[model samples]
Target chain A: MSVSLDPVNIADKLSLIDELWTQRKIAGLNDYEIKLAKLKGEFVWHTHPETDELFVVVSGRLTIRLREGDVVLGPGELYVVPRGVEHCPVAEEETAVMLVEPVGTLNTGDTGGPMTRAAEPL
Target chain B: MSVSLDPVNIADKLSLIDELWTQRKIAGLNDYEIKLAKLKGEFVWHTHPETDELFVVVSGRLTIRLREGDVVLGPGELYVVPRGVEHCPVAEEETAVMLVEPVGTLNTGDTGGPMTRAAEPL
Candidate 1:
């Protein structure tokens, strides 16, 4: 497959996304995928047994709740939820986030449920 | 090694970097690493034969010159340079960027020289 050489404007992509908690793949580096998601309220508590998940808040605030404590993030802040660690992402208002994870990694992770959805290209 | 659950503020880390073109590791996701770099002027033309390199502009603008064409990126923009493609990053003014690539991927890629430096933690 041919890789496009165009730059992806994060804000533009995020504006096109209307669904909350749905990840849209923007780019790929090696086997990992860079995804953008609009998040609100709360996400399911889950763990990825095989890989770490990186969350970068693009707009608004995000609180990553772990068993130990909550890692609150604002715009331009990032947090990594380590492998096998349960994390639930919560946001009071609408938040734009960029996520980096391995290809095929689930959004709901090991605790797949109604919120689980496969990522599609934006 | 224990992973810290603290949120890494991208602007805060960028403020700590003094030298241009130097990369500092901020977080790790599986075998890949997330890095922050301050860049200005031109970088050496290089290619990562083994992996693709991702660049996200946090502040200012960046131009990734590939053999095919130039990809201009402004703040909140990103582009992925495919593996084996020669690329040279240039910024007219000081730019803060976030990079995602495999662990041990060099700043200079296959063309290591005076511009090459090992990434240290931020």
Candidate 2:
């Protein structure tokens, strides 16, 4: 490496996996975290009232659905869901991505449904 | 999309580019932000005194250099550079990544050397 660093390189952490629904915690502050989430197929619909989430698709394709419509995020693209907004995430095929938000975040926002929470902290 | 969404999908935002040195703001709290930074080549040497930055390598390869040694962050790998730590980041080839830090973060931290600040807010 020739360039001098600031103190961290979070992008390096996201390369750990290439599968769907994989959550890898790369870095965080007291209230927020940077995570790598891989996705395939479809996920349950949910929302968060306390904080907004930032999703960046590093590879493959990604889409987010709101109550009214859906937004598609591709490589080098991003979307912000304001707090308390209900939305769903689904990938037609295998997709790799990164997530930044607070810690202890519930997958389904405040409403816990059948597929709301994630079991592991990869 | 089948999974319930919190307020954001940062990975979806990252998919907006594939070039090097492209900085895109995905989301942020009052003081922090989730960014998708496209990087290549070697960056300047610098450090920050008040904040620690997280870099997650989503594609290609990434490496962080400190005065003592260098830590390489491959895809899916993560490293935390404590505040006031001096380091450098370099990629032998083009790499895609996600960065999480504060809103007014300096690329070279407080030291401010050549290549310390970014000109754009992508």
Candidate 3:
């Protein structure tokens, strides 16, 4: 599908989420995938040992808790979680975020838990 | 630098552009790079033989002209120009965009001209 004609409205997509946190794949560029994720509360601490993950805040606030320090992001701000770094994401309220990573990446990375779920393609 | 604390603001970065079209690299993701660009007119036609280009519109509008047709994008919209596909970008008005591509991919792709320039890291 052509993304230009139907640009994914992040708010519209996030509003349909039934779970506390959910990820929806919006577009795929060869080996890379762009996803929209709605997050609330806290996620399981995890690390992607093979690939970096790019997170762009679309709305609300998000924080990546690391052992060294915490990274907080606001709308229009982006952060890249380096590979092999342990991090946990937390959202005080409903938040919308954009994620860029490899096509087959898992949400929980090297760790898995109840938060682990396959991404739904938009 | 950590991306979380210094999250790149798409609007703030684009507002400082002095050229008709300029790209600024905000962060690197292993082999990929995230860039912000401000466009106000037509750019040279080009094609990347080895990598697809992902373009996400942050504000205003942008059109990617291809031999098959034209792909137009607006705020929050995204499009991926497949590798080796001849294309040209044109912005009727001032527009802010985010680009995701390989680390060393050139703006003009296989073709080179006055439009070719090095990307400034943010």
**Winner by TM-score:** 1
Higher-scoring candidate on lDDT, 2 or 3: 3
Residue B61 miss distance in model 3 (angstroms): 0.8
Candidate order by DockQ, decreasing, is: 1, 3, 2
Cα lDDT tens digits for candidate 1, B61-103: 9999987788999999999999999989999999999999998
Q: What is the lDDT, from 0 to 100, of the residue B29 in candidate 2?
A: 51
Model 1 chain A: worst 10 consecutive residues (lDDT sum): A1-10
Q: Give me the candidate number with maximum DockQ.
A: 1
Tell me the spans in candidate 2 whose CA falls farther than 4 Å from its real position. A1-30, A38-41, A58-60, B1-30, B36-44, B58-61, B74-78, B91-97
- Estimate, for each residue in A7-116, the C-alpha lDDT of model 1 and write its tens digit: 99999999899999999999988888999999999899998999999999999999999988899999999998999998899999999999999899999999999999
Would you estimate the TM-scores of all the predictions?
A: 0.97, 0.68, 0.92
What tier of docking accuracy does candidate 3 attain?
medium
Q: Rank the candidates by lDDT, best first.
A: 1, 3, 2
